[model samples]
Target: MIDVIGPWNRMHHQDTLEAMFRLRHQVFVEEMGWDLPLARNGRETDQFDTARTIYLVYRDEDGAVAGSMRLIPSVLPHVLGDVFPELCSGPVPRGPAIFESSRSCISRKARRKDPNGMIWGALTCGMIEYAMLRELDFITAVMDRRMVDMARVADWHLNPLGPERRIAGGGVVAVTMPIDTHALDTVRLQRGVPDPVLSLRFAGARAA
Candidate 1:
């Protein structure tokens, strides 16, 4: 299940958050070789993991962190605005209706079993659904070429903020993806999920 999170419930999921950090450490640092700060305790986190960050954590029946992603309000300091401003043609898009998404990851263990890319679809669809539910207009990010292509083929109303440029490992570009009912419908059709990817009926309680 994909669990939506906000400042209100962040402290209640310390254990899940820690597990997610560990999974991120394994995927981004150890496997992908990203030069991010490695916590002494082996969790991978940055200054961006703040109370304001909204998260969607995909966990299985046994409570394992299969995949996760986070959203930072554009009004706040975020990677696209502070670190990769050069990637875009002008000032990054910032407003109450737009948010910057980052730190998306899926555990290697989960990937090994998900050959159909269902997990990926679920995460992306859930993110879009969650954003629209919050009345957000769009979600922008600096994504690599492969991710850009995925968004393109997935039929997202993606608008490139700038041309793709050579980066450390490959090409990357800034993009703004719309979050609306039409986009959500297309994603559902593409993924063939009749119901919302998440059981988004939050009751102000811990996800079961």
Candidate 2:
């Protein structure tokens, strides 16, 4: 199940949030070696993780953080806008109805259990559901080429903002993914998830 954690309910999920940070450290720092300065003490975090950020955390049967992603309002400072502006050909897209997704990762344990990538599919579905609930228009991200390819295979309507560039020893591209019923249905159909993935507890949470 996926839990949506926002400022409205952050105090109730500190342990889960910490586990998410550690999972990020394991994936982005220990495994991928991405040179993130804020990764310290077995936690991967940065300035962007603030009160305004919304987190989607996927938990396994044992309630361990299996995968997670964060959503930051595009109107605020985000990684693509503040750190990798060169990845965009023109101005970085920003608005109340737009969000930037970052720090997406799945734990090794979950990957081992999900050989067919259903966990990733669930996370993606949850994000789309949350976007739909909040009436968001677009989601932007700076993703590695491999992830971009996966998005293509999943049939996400991705609009590239700039040409792919080699960053941190890999091809990375900036893209805007349209948020609509079509995009959500495509992922659900391809992943064999016919039901909504976001936790019902916060599924109806309004945008702050």
Candidate 3:
């Protein structure tokens, strides 16, 4: 199951948020060796994790956080605009209808149980579903080049914002993914998830 946590209801989901942060620390800091200052105390958080930031969390059958991703309004400070503007040859895409996706990760326990990558697919589908529900036009992200291929396999319509650059010892590129029903349906079909993933309780919350 997936949970949509936004600013308005974030206070009600403290435990879920903490689990998501711990999962991020495990995947990004301990495993990937990212030198993040906020990644202490077994929880990974950053300046971007503001009240307005929205989160999509995937919990396994045991109700443990298996995978997660964050969505920040493009108009606000984001990773591509604030930290890695050089990755984009042109101006960073910014608008009310655009959002920046970042800090996507899956927990080790989930990976061991989910050999088919259903968690990853569920997170991707949830992101697209939330975008469509919020009437977002595009979702921008700075991710490893390999993710580009994954996006293709998932049938997501992605447009590269700039050429790939060697960053943090990996090939990273900025991209903008168009949000539409076609992309959503394609991902749902590919992932074999015919039902919506976003939690109904928060899926219809007002855009932050």
Compute each candidate's TM-score over C-alphas.
0.91, 0.95, 0.95
Runs of candidate 1 exceeding 4 Å displacement: 202-208
What is the TM-score of candidate 2?
Answer: 0.95
- Residues 59-102, candidate 3: write the lDDT tens digits: 88888888999999998999999999998989999999999999
| Model 2 steric clash pairs | none
Please rank every candidate by lDDT, starting with the best. Answer: 2, 3, 1
lDDT of 2 by residue, 1-208 (tens): 6899998889999999999999999999999887898889999999999999999999889878999999999989999999999999999999999999998999998899888888888888888888888889889999988888887877786888999999868899999988888988888888776488877445447746
Candidate models: Cα lDDT each? 0.81, 0.89, 0.88
- When summed lDDT is taken over every stretch of 10 residues in candidate 3, the lowest stretch is 199-208
Per-prediction RMSD in angstroms?
Answer: 3.0, 1.4, 1.5
Tens-place lDDT per residue, model 1, 1-208, is 6887778777888888888889888888888988886454678888888878888898866778899998888989898998889889987899988889899999888888887667777888888887766777789998988877876787776888988988776898999988877777777777665457765666442212
